[model samples]
Target: MKKLSVFFALLFLAFVSLPAHAGEIPIGIYGTLTGTDTDVNGMSYGPKDYLTYVNERAGGVMGHKYVPILLDGKNSIPEEVKVFKRLVEVEKVVLVNGWSTGGTKALRDQINTLIKIPFQAQSLSSDVLDPQKYPFIFLLGPTYEDQVLIALNYAKQKGAKTFAFIHADIEYGRAPVRNALEQKIPEKLGLKVLADIEYAGGSPDLTPQLLRVKELNPDYVYIQDSAGNTVKILRDAAKVGVPAGKFFGNNYNFQHIIPGTLGKDAEGFKALQINADWGENIPMMKEIEEFGRKQKIEKKDAYYTKGWVQGKVIHELISRVLKKTGGKIPEIGQFRIMLKDEWVKLENFDTGGGTPALFYKDHQGHTQARIVEVKAGKFATISDWIKTR
Candidate 1:
C-alpha cells in the first residue's frame, strides 16, 4: 500500500509540472499601451495581432502555436525593466519585443550578459547599433543617425544652406541630434547648424521655443519627437511665422493621424517613410486588410505596417529553427540562441513591400527610406527610395 501511494504522488507532480498549453511558443512583447506615448501603441499590438492571425488562420508555425505575452511598459525605463524580468525569469519567453530608446538602452547590458534572450527593439537609436556589444538586439529599420543624414541630404539637395534642430528633451529625441552634430553630418552635407533647441515633451505650449526658432529663422528645421509633440511644434511654428514646409521629421513623425489632426497646418510637413503606408496596393497590405476586416485595426498607419513586417520576420525565423530541429521546439535557452543565429542569416528577404528587401547582417533589418511630404493633407512619396548606408 505504501509503494502504490508513492507512485500516485509522483504521477500528480508530473502532471502539474507540464506546461498549461503544451508546444506553445511564448514571445514577450511590451510597449506603451496606455500611457503618455500611447500614440504609437500600435507598435506593440502589430506583432501580437500578426501572431494571432497566424494562430487562427494557419494553426501556428509547424504545429507549435505562438503565444504572444504582451504587457504595458508605460514607456518608463523602470517599468520596462520590471516587465523584462517577469518575461525572462518567470514567463521564460524565448524572445522579447521591447519599446522606447531609453528602456532599450537601459536594459542593453542586462539583456546581453544575464538574460541572453533575443530582443527586438522599436528604437532606431544609433547608440544601440553595436552588434559586438549587444549581440542579441535587433532593430526594424535604419538608425536615427541614418535618418538624420538622409534628411540633411534632402535639405541640401533642396538648396538649404542652414538648418536647426528642435527636439524633445529625452533620450529618444536628443540622442540622434547629438550624434549628428558630433559627427559633423550637417557640415559634411554643406549645411550650417543654426540652433539646437530642446523642449520638454508634451508641453502644452511651444510658442516660446518657436519664437526662438523664428529669431534664428534657419532655412530648415529637423524635428525629433513623437507624433503628439510634432503636432505641437507645427502649430506653434505656424504661429511663430515658420513655414511648415521647412520642417522635416524622422520616421516616427510619419503618421496619418498627424495630418488628419492638423489638416492644413500639417500640409507641407515632410517625414521619412521607412515602411509602406497602410492601404497601399502592396502584397502585405492584402493580409493586413483582410485581418482588419475581421477585427478593428488599432492604428491604420505605417507603424502597423512595420509591426506586421516584424511578425513576418519572427514567423520566418521560428519556422527555420523548427525545420532544423526536426519540427520540435528545443529547450528555451537553445531556442533563443538558434533564433538569434537564424536572424542574422536573413538577406535580401522580401517583406511583401513593407520596406525594401531587408538585410540583417548588421542587425538592422532595412536601411532604405524615402521622403514623404504632406500634400493635400495626405502623405505622398516624393523621391525614390534613398539608401542610408
Candidate 2:
C-alpha cells in the first residue's frame, strides 16, 4: 500500500505540472533561412520570436499555446512545396507565414484547392491580391507593381523621362518588371522604358550590364533584386561609370547592409520603404525590445519589423476566434475557415507604426509606402507616404 501510494503521488505531480493550456496551436513560418537569399531570413525569424514572446508573456492566448514551426525553403520551389506538405499534413498548422514570390506563386493553387489554410505571404505580388480567386492568401504591403509605379512617379517628378530595369534572373526579380511593362504603368506615368536587363544573382561582376545601362543612358534605372545583388550592382555601376545616384530599388533592396557593404558607392541609392526600420520609436518596438532582453533577436531590420507586424496580426485573429468560440479551440478545419472569414473583416488594424494602419479587405493589409534614400550610411525617408490604392 505504501509503494502504491508513492507511485500514485508521482503520477499526480506529473499530471499537475503539465501546461495549463488545453492544446497547442501550430503556426507554420517558412522562408529562405539558407541558400542564396538568406539575407531576408529575418522575415522568418521575426514571427517566430514574436510568437515565442506571446507564449512566454501572455501564456499562449487564452489557454491555447502558439507553436511556431520554422522551415527553410532554400529559396527553391520544389523545396518550398515539400515544406508546405510537411507543415499542413504532418504538423497540421492552422495558419502559415510564407516567403518568396516564386514559392508563393507556386503554392497558390494548392493553398486554394487542397490545404485551405490562411497564408500570409511575404511576397507583394499583385497576382495573389484577388481575394475572390486567392481567398486564403494575404500580403502585408503594396504590390510589386505598386512599388514600381511609385518609383516611376518619383522619377517623372524629378524630370526624368526614360528609365531602365535591371533585375536578377529569377521569378521574383523578373515578375515586377514584367508586370509593370505589361500594365503600361511607365507610359502612364509619362516615363519610357528603355532597357530591361537581367543578371544572375550574386554575380562576380555586373560591369557588362552596367556598361549596357550606360550606353542606353536612361535617366533612371530601377533595380529589382535582393540586397546582396543590389550591393553588387552598385559596386559594378561605379566601376563602369553608371552613376549610382540614377539607380532605384524595390523594397527588398532597401537594406542596411547595402550601405554597410558598398560604403560611398551605395550613397544616394533609393528604394521603397514599407515597414519602419528597427529601433524606431514605436509602440510595437517596446514589446520587441522587452522580448529581446530575454532572447536573441535574429534579424534586426525592416524585415524583422515586417515579421513582428505579421505576428501581431496572427495574435489578433486567433484571439478573436477564441473569443467567438468561448475559449474552446474548434477542430482544425473549422478553425481554419473561421480564420479566413475573420481576416477579411480586419480593418484599421494598428501595427504600432510598423506600417500604416492595416486593412485586409482586399487581402493586402497596407497599400501605402514611402521612398527612402541611402544618406550617410543609413536609409532616410525622402518622400511622404504614397498611397498605391
User: Please, what are the lDDT tens digits per residue for candidate 1 over residues 16-52?
Assistant: 7754444889999999987777887778888988998
Instruction: Tell me the TM-score of each prediction against the true structure.
Output: 0.93, 0.94
Summarize candidate 2's per-residue lDDT along 261-312 as a digit string, tens digits.
8888888999998888888999999999999999999889888988999999
Give the winner by TM-score. Answer: 2
User: Which residues of candidate 2, in runs, are more than 4 Å off?
Assistant: 1-21
Clashes of 1: 0
The lowest-lDDT stretch of 10 consecutive residues in candidate 2 is 14-23
lDDT of each: 0.89, 0.90
